[model samples]
Target chain A: MNRYSLNQATTKYWSLEDVVAASAKADLSWIGLWREPVQEYGVERSTKLVTDAGLRVSSLCRSGFFTSTDAAERQAKIEDNRRAIDEAAALGTDVLILVSGGLPSGSRDLDGARAMVRDGIAELAPYAQEAGVRLAIEPLHPMFCSDRCVVSSLGGALDLAEQFPVEQVGVVVDAYHLWWDADVYRQIERAGARICSYQVSDWVVPLPADTLLGRGMMGDGSIELRRLREACDAAGYDGPVEVEIFNQDLWNAPGQEVFDLALARYGEHVA
Target chain B: MNRYSLNQATTKYWSLEDVVAASAKADLSWIGLWREPVQEYGVERSTKLVTDAGLRVSSLCRSGFFTSTDAAERQAKIEDNRRAIDEAAALGTDVLILVSGGLPSGSRDLDGARAMVRDGIAELAPYAQEAGVRLAIEPLHPMFCSDRCVVSSLGGALDLAEQFPVEQVGVVVDAYHLWWDADVYRQIERAGARICSYQVSDWVVPLPADTLLGRGMMGDGSIELRRLREACDAAGYDGPVEVEIFNQDLWNAPGQEVFDLALARYGEHVA
Candidate 1:
């Protein structure tokens, strides 16, 4: 059966308890969580809450910001990722998502930064494999290429995955980052079975200022969700489709309202 | 010698004649005029003003919006591009820039749209080639991928160029669009003499709303102009670097002030 998971970032205004309660009320089967909330509630307590509520942990929000030119800084990021893997293991999460950070400060050496990303992922893959937490590389929107992720295309992420063992490194295909790509369908086909997670959101035209928080909710913007789902289905990916929106307007609304809206939209547009 | 050309979009408030006079007063070697102004002032009169001011027309502002799923609509776009090429030739400009339009309405077929773009360009290239004008593909910011140009990377543009005769298909390396790309340096090296125009501008962090119009002036944002210049220089591109900006605030200012600021910034940061 197709399932929907709420990425906690969608309703960041809500506390962990609020999210769990709302997820249970919304009858959602799965939930994707971020590290900050788990840390805030104490991982043990948060784990207990999800377990008590009978919600499956789909995946943890993130584990990588791996493009540091400095060796020490790069090593520290990898160490931090190892801890995130441990956290994912504790929560019995299936995947630990990774974001390739942008170019190091004051440097226009994009290839060098990409090399650093490859090295960083290679260093962390072994530990993630041992911990049973699949490392899923999330290619952010190309707008974030300068400060967030050097890996901006699914093909680019797949190219990076070639460096790792098959089961260890995979990709998180978020519609927001790739919906507009000319080669998306072909790349999704190429990413078959290697796609660790599927994330959905809409692309709002004339992007707002403070772009980080301006993401649109499902069906509220221009993405053809049905087509994207068809592509995912054809690609042999049966993972929980996670809803990850970062809209300021939605975030400011009541947590229950946001969850209800996500649930209704997911059923109408994606189910 | 390093020479500067002001892309009139930076000071959109100025009339074409006023912009030419301002360019002359600034002692700049060239000026880039837009289609609307040329139509408004009459192409012949604008040409004479540029000639009288001893200013060379660096390149025309734009020409292509090729991505249409509709056959007739797409053909109409090609016809429009033919006229744009004639205008560029009339102005004695070396390059007629092309921007591949975004996804067609109600279509999630990115590949289909790209095919339309390629076919459109192929149909239009002969006219440009015959007119002795180069059609430069300007890969816009990836943020514009949905509604603006689908071609968002230098590599992607170069790939498109490889499908056609080299002289008929070239690329405009706009720093604002290519600066964030991870493979920009290598792609620039690959572009080499195939680069028809080099556009310089900065990427301001925390961009304002109406992102299309919020482009920062040179040196006011984070882009490393000198590094890109060096890369282009190393790649054997000795073309005049054109300053193209689309800031609403700057556009609201007087033309003389805008040209002076562009010249000063180009000398201090770009030259």
Candidate 2:
């Protein structure tokens, strides 16, 4: 079955209550909740709303900005991730998506920053394993390599994942990020069953901004979503095709309208 | 010895005559000649002017954009690059830099575009080798992944190089493009003597524009030039440090003044 999951950020204009009601109204069987929304409604209430609506938590929004040189900061990040994992487990999310952060302050040594990320993940893997939530390391686009994430390739994420047990460490192949990678298909195959989630969003060829908020809607941009879906399906990833858009324009629209657009686009282009 | 080369675009306000005079006055050992300047001066006069000024050609400014999917278009690019190689040879350049082109039209398949680039390089390799010029693949910043070179990493370039004999393929580690790569040091080690040219420029964290024209001058931005030079030196790469800035503001300034600033920054920050 081709299931469509609405990542809450697409309609960030809505409150947690608003999103839950809208998700129920839209008849979306799956939804990805963010940290702020979960915190706002309290995890128990958020979990209850999902249960009541009969909606599955596709995955938690994120958990891993693990790129720090300081020991205390790194430990704090790991602890924060542990909380995120606990929340994912509570929400019955199968995966806790991780976005490895960028270079530490004043540190131009990229290799050193990457080692810190690996160590930070290694430190947190046991707790994630014990919590029953798969840690999905999402490789952000190379544009975010400096400020947002150092892990900018599926190959790099897989290299990091190889350090941990397969059940605990997996990768989220977000099309918007991995679409520009030359080895996407090969890496997707390499990821195989370890791909915890497959995400879809188009790469707006001419990015309007350099920050995180300029992502395009699934079909509005230039990415060949059908080909990406074919690759993911071929790789045995029979998961929800999560619609994750970080566009400011989409976020400003009404929740139901955004949800409807995503659903329509999914059916028309992605499915 | 630390050798300095002025990339003509850095002092774009100057004509070819002014650039040659400025280099002579600056006591700079070399200058990277661009196509526009060459065409303006006629290749014969351009080569003679540099020779008269006792300046060497470190490299020809560029020659690749090989992302066109059509065989004829791709072949035209190769032919253009061959002409560039001849230009480089006439000027006694050690390398003809190749800026591998962006995503082909109507295509989101980055791997396929990269394969086209590899084939383009393979076809151009013999022409370059026969002319006694090395083809240096300059991996652009990831921001350029879509509309520019899909080769966004030193590792990616090295991986491509492994497809051919080592002597024919090499990489240009431009600090602006590769300052944020996690595997830079390891890739540098892997590149070893294949590191044909080292270009320096700073990465302004929040890029002012999506285009390639806003590049920051060496000490004005975040890149650690001395440290990168140390890494290159440690990896047994003793090459001339070419200053390549693409700033509009700097380009508007007097050419001699820009050269003075670049030379001062090069000595203070890079030497």
TM-score of the B chain in each candidate versus the native B chain: 0.97, 0.96
Instruction: Indicate which candidate wins on TM-score.
Output: 2
Q: Candidate 2 residues B1-271, lDDT tens each?
A: 2478888878887888888888887777888889777977899889999999999998887898998878898878888988898999898887889888888877777778888889989998887888888889988877688788889888889888778776787889898888765567778888887888888988766766545775888877657788888888888888788888988888888777788888889888888
Error of 2 at B35 (Å): 0.9
Q: How many collisions per candidate? A: 0, 1
User: How displaced is residue A190 in candidate 1, in Å?
Assistant: 4.6
DockQ per model, Cα: 0.40, 0.45
lDDT of 1 by residue, A6-122 (tens): 999999989989898888876778899999989889888888999889898899988799877688898899889988999998888869999989878766566787788888888
Global CA lDDT computed for model 1: 0.83
- Docking model 2 quality class: acceptable
TM-score of chain A of each: 0.97, 0.96
Query: Ten residues in a row with the worst lDDT in model 1 chain B?
Result: B105-114
Q: Write the per-residue lDDT of candidate 2 for residues A78-197, one digit (tens) a residue.
A: 999989999999999879999989878766666777788788788888888888888999988766776778887888899899888899899998888877655678888888888988
DockQ score of the complex predicted as candidate 1: 0.40
Which digits, one per residue and each the tens of the lDDT, describe model 1 over residues B1-271?
Answer: 2467888888888878778877787677788888888988988888888988998998997888988777899889888898899889999987988889987876655667777888888888887889988899998887887787888788888878879887898999999987865468889999987888889988766667887875788877657788898899899888789999988788888777887888889888898
Regions of candidate 2 where Cα sits further than 4 Å from its true position: A68-76, A233-236, B69-72, B163-167, B219-236, B252-257
Measured with C-alpha atoms, the lDDT of residue B246 in candidate 1 is 87
